[model samples]
Structures are given as C-alpha cells and as structure tokens.
Target: MNDPIRGTARGSAPAPLSVLDTALAGRGVSAADALSGSIALAELAERRGFTRYWVTEHHSMPGVSSSSPAVLLARLTAHTTRLRLGAGGVMLPNHPPLIVAEQYGLLQALAPDRIDLGLGRAPGTNQATAAALRRGRSDDDFPQQVVELLRFLDDDFPEEHPYRERVYAVPGPGQDKENGLPQTTGRPSVWLLGSSGYSAQLAARLGLPFAFAAHFSPDHVAGALRLYRDRFTPSAVLTEPYALASFAVMAADDEHEALRQTRSYAHSMMRMLHGKSYLVPTADEAASYPYTASEQLVLDRWTNTVLHGTPDRVTVHLDRLHEAARPDEIMIASVGHTPQALLRSTELIADAYTLPSTPVPVSAR
Candidate 1:
C-alpha cells in the first residue's frame, strides 16, 4: 500500500509561508538586542510579502525575550504597518480569560485588522515556572477556559450569566450599538495552537483555526491534523477547518553553512533536556562540546526534526512537508547563532519560493 501522506516534487508551487520568532538571544547578546532583532525580522518579512509575523511567549528563559506577546506586539505595531502580529501563542492556562480578551482587544484597537490571538494550553515554560505563573490556579479546566475566552471575545454571554452584566470587553467586537450602549470596535482573530490531538479536537469542536507545533514536537503532527480534520465542525468564526503546520527551518547560500547554524539549536535543545538554561551557544562552542553516545542520540533526534540546507534543498523539503501535511498555511520557525544568519535564512527562503514583495496597503491596515 502507498503511504497515507503524499509527497510533492521540487519546483512545485509553494504554500503561503509565515514567520514565528521566539526572540532567541544569540551568544553574548542581551534580551534587548534579541527583541530588536525580532523587529528587524518582522520588517524584512513584511517586505518579503510573508503572510504573518508571530512572536512566541516564554518565561524565565535567558535565551528568549518574548515573555509577554501582547506587550511585544504593541511595540511591533509601531515598527510594522501591514504584517499581522500575534502570539504564536499565549499560554491560556497562565492567564485569566477576561484579561486575555482585554489585552488582545486592545491590540486589535491599536492595529485593527492586523492582529491575531493564538491560544495554547501549555504553560510555555518548565514545571516550576508554570507553578509560579499559575499561582495556585488549576489548568485542568482548559476546555471551560476556552469557552469562557470565546464568550468574552464575542461578548456573547447569556442573559442570566453572572459576569454578563458585571463585565464587558472594552472596544467590543465592532461598531454596532443598541439602547445607547457603546459598540465594540475591535476583536482579534483567535486561533488554537497545539502539538497534540487534544488541542486539535478542541479547536475543531469550537470551529477555530488550529496551528500545530511541528517545529519542536514532530511526533504528533500527522495524528493531530488527522483528528482535527476528521472531527471539525463549522462555527461562526470558521466555515471549514483551517490548519497551519509550523516547521523548524534554516536556509542559506551554502548547504554546509546552513547545517552548521543548526548546531546551535541542537546544543540549545541538549541544554534544555539536561535542565540547564537554554541559552543559544556559538557554532564553534556547539561543535566542540563533548557528548556521550546517549546524548549524541538525543541531539540527533532533535536536530532531525529541523530542515537545514541550501535554498534549493530547503525549498524541496518544505514542498514535501506541505504535501504530506496539507496544511492551509506553512509557518517557519527560524533560529541561528547570529542575527544576520537568521535574517538571511528568511530572505533566502522567501526568494527561493518567489514570495511576493508587495506590502499590504496602509488603507487595509
């Protein structure tokens, strides 16, 4: 029997690509520098005609600076005009649903149509950090939290709901008024992000778009997508199932250099696995680090999930991934030892795929 997943040949039309930045600090770089790098990359992505520019949320990590996506997005809005800014995502379990809605609602008010709210159940941090962030709250009720979040966003609470009359999401959905009530002027588009079938099922059941974190957790990509499509139901937000598959990618002029840049990511992962701070190391440092056979195996497994090569080779790899997953959109999570290399990788991929260079109109923004 043939494999369930299909494969696309080289030179095929590429799917829409977007960028997912973690604001990873390079060796000897400060978090401020990393954030500046993220803004520069978003500007580049906008110029390259990429679909969206998403920043992730992480806590207490020396190498990552995107601790608060909403705050970062607020800064990003001043630097970018047309690129869609979003949290790739905010760990919903870490925050109250009302606050999440209010924050994203304010974002929408700031940039209007160019805002997205990607919600995830994961703490986006380690267990100890998760505990500190949660502060005695239970994350076991994720489904209920999601429902409540949606209700807050839509201002759709029932008449008898206790909070319905007591609270309201400011700058509500749109400019529609009734009985002299101030109409809601903005609401960010929401998406469910996950690396497992549970999130897929939830997104499908709720009719929200789903984004799978194949970049780090490759094992569940196929299963999650399958479950999502198989069980999807239409909702007011989405008429049909829409899924985005995020992949770790690095492309360069030379295949060897591209592969070398990935060594830093490998070292970072190894550190994370060993319960060490995941500060990105230099390529030379990563190369010189001694590893046991078992540790080497772990590194190899983690690195295998990333696509790294010359632009031509990387393009072919992306094509195959698109064919197999059949996601509506493809999101690239690019990392490197240097800011220049990371920006160059994105540029090379955009050129390889012949992505448009036109910016979204200011009128649209």
Candidate 2:
C-alpha cells in the first residue's frame, strides 16, 4: 500500500494527544504582555515535546487578545527556539488574501520549518463582528478566499497572476534550520479546520490535512471525521485521508481539581454567551460561583464535546476518540489563569499521551 501522508510529518500520529493553548491571553493576563507570555508557553511545549503551538485569531474578543496571529507568531518566533508555531486558525472569511500571505510569509522567513498555516472558514465570531471585519464578501466568497490564500503562500503564482502585484510574502523563503530544528520550506504546511461536514468534504477533496474542532464542537466530531475520510482524495497537499482531531483537556493529580477547573471554564463560557461580567475566572473563583440551570445546560453540552478530568480519566475517552477518528495528530486545547498551571497541563499530557516510540505504519509509510 502506498502510504498516505508519508514525509508529511514526524509527530503526526493519533495516539499522542498534542496540546493547543488557544486564548492564552484569556488567562486573565494583560493583553500587551499576555502575548509574550503565550510565546513562553510555546517554548515550554517544545521543551515538553509538543507537536505544535498554535495561536487563534479573534477580533474584539474580551477574553482573548490574539486578534492577529501573524503578529503574535512573529513575536513568538523570537522567543521560542523550537516548536512549530502557527495559527490554530486564521479565519479566512475575516481577511483578504494578500494580507495573510505577506504576513505569514514574513513569519516563515523568521522561522522557516517551524510554521503551519491552519485556516478555518468560519468567521470565528458573531455576525456583528463578521460585518466589522469585511462588509462586502458574500457567503460563496469564503472558499475562494481559502484557495486564494494557498495560491499566495505556496508562491506558485506567476507574474501574470491576477493578485501578484497586490500580494507578496516578502524576503521570501530563506528560512532554514541549523541543527535538528524545524524550518519552513518558505511556505508553511496548511490544514483545513472545521466542525461540520462541509469542511470535511473540502479537506478531503483538496487532500489537505483535516483538523476537526471537536474541542468545542463535539456534537459533530464523529460525523465530520467520517465525511472527511470517506470523501478523501489524493492531492498535492495530501495523498490520502489524514486528520488532526482536537478536544479540550484538563489534567491534574486529582480528578476533583480537573472538574473544578472545568466548572470555571463553563462558568466563564456562560458569562460570554449571556450578558454578564466577562472574565476568565480562576479555578478558585469558578468553584465559588453559583451555577444556574441555564449554566448547567451549557456545561453539559460542552462536556459531551470536551475531554476533561485527570490524565487517567481523560485518556480513556481520548483513546476511544482516537480509534474512531484515527487522526494524524491529536491536539489538546487548554487555558488557565496561571501560566504555571497551563504549563503543568502541557507537561502532564506530553508525559501521558505521546505517540509510541516506534512510528506506527502510516499509509504512506
């Protein structure tokens, strides 16, 4: 069998659950300094041997300040000696092609092999925020935007390319590795992110890596994964069905502490969804809050999708999920009030859920 996704990656496997710390700024840190510290988290992930460090983009988000992934990633590259630093997703619908191309291109220049450019078609915000980002695009323009972005980043466009003059990923492609480090081959690896069958179909058809947003969109995980694998075709980006499944995780020495942390997250989510004081409360503060039936309902919905509890407890569910999805990599998303707590979670997962020492037999292997 011709292996699928061969030479695609060193850490792209399903067993080890990779950790993704999005909304790092939401840990109640000052926006200005939070990004720097978030980069520190990325460094820690590398030290802990995580697969990657991805920051998300969101405009006008109170709890998070990662509104510009390119900018933050640049800062991160300067601080982190290792770790593949990239966007958990740069929402394609929110921006135009050249802007993203040039920005991430610059990032690749700074840290070549250590980059990935995952794109999500979702606005990642409400309609109000979407309108604020760009007022002209229609619903159909979303996929076009993604196609345009890939064309720009891959540097495959010709001089006659319609957007070439207006677009450039400057100081192009000189990034290289000195030691056993990761380097972008000028253009970063691209992945399609989604929570629905639509994205699944798109990823499969394009033969690109697929990452399901099961961290928050658990309701559709199994279905979406099925669609992605079933409809998969071989393309330049990928030769067969390769996936990176994600789920929220919280680990601690004790199960009670894990649940306590989840309660805080649930409470904060309620504040975000409803009109309430919005803050990413500490576990202590969350444990103190009085959750209502409304909040409980919200918690239940997320719990179905989120992987919570101690490593032992969480692994059982994650293992079941891995068997079902058979992802190339599994990313665990987490955030906490203190950076120490966040780092601890990263270390815990790395120690407990990493892939087997010997590589599994990949389709392309």
Scored by lDDT, the top model is 1
In order, candidate lDDTs are 0.81, 0.68
Lowest lDDT block of 10, candidate 1 = 1-10
Local accuracy of candidate 2 as per-residue lDDT tens digits, 1-365: 11222222233234544556654545456776566567656766655556677887776656677788888888777766545777879888777777777787778778867778888877766667778887866447767777877876765566787755554455443222323345344577788888888889988888888888887777678888888989999987666677877888777778777776666666666776875544567777776767788887885665445567777677777778878766667787765555555666666666565532332223211
Where does candidate 1 stray beyond 4 Å?
A: 1-13, 173-186, 359-365
Query: Can you write out model 1's per-residue Cα lDDT over 1-365, one digit (the tens) per residue?
Result: 11111112212346667889998786887878888888889888777777788999998787788899999899888877767789999899999998998898888888877888898988888889999999987678988998998888788889899977567766565224433666545467789999988889999999888999999787678788989999999987678888888999888789788877887888788888888887788888888889999778877877788899998888798888887878878889987777778889998888888766766455533
TM-score of 2: 0.83
Worst 10-residue stretch by lDDT in candidate 2? Answer: 1-10
Per-residue lDDT, model 1, residue 171, is 54
TM-score of 1: 0.92
Q: Which has the greatest TM-score?
A: 1
The pairs that clash in candidate 2 are 3-363, 3-364, 4-363, 4-364, 13-328, 18-332, 112-183, 112-184, 113-183, 113-184
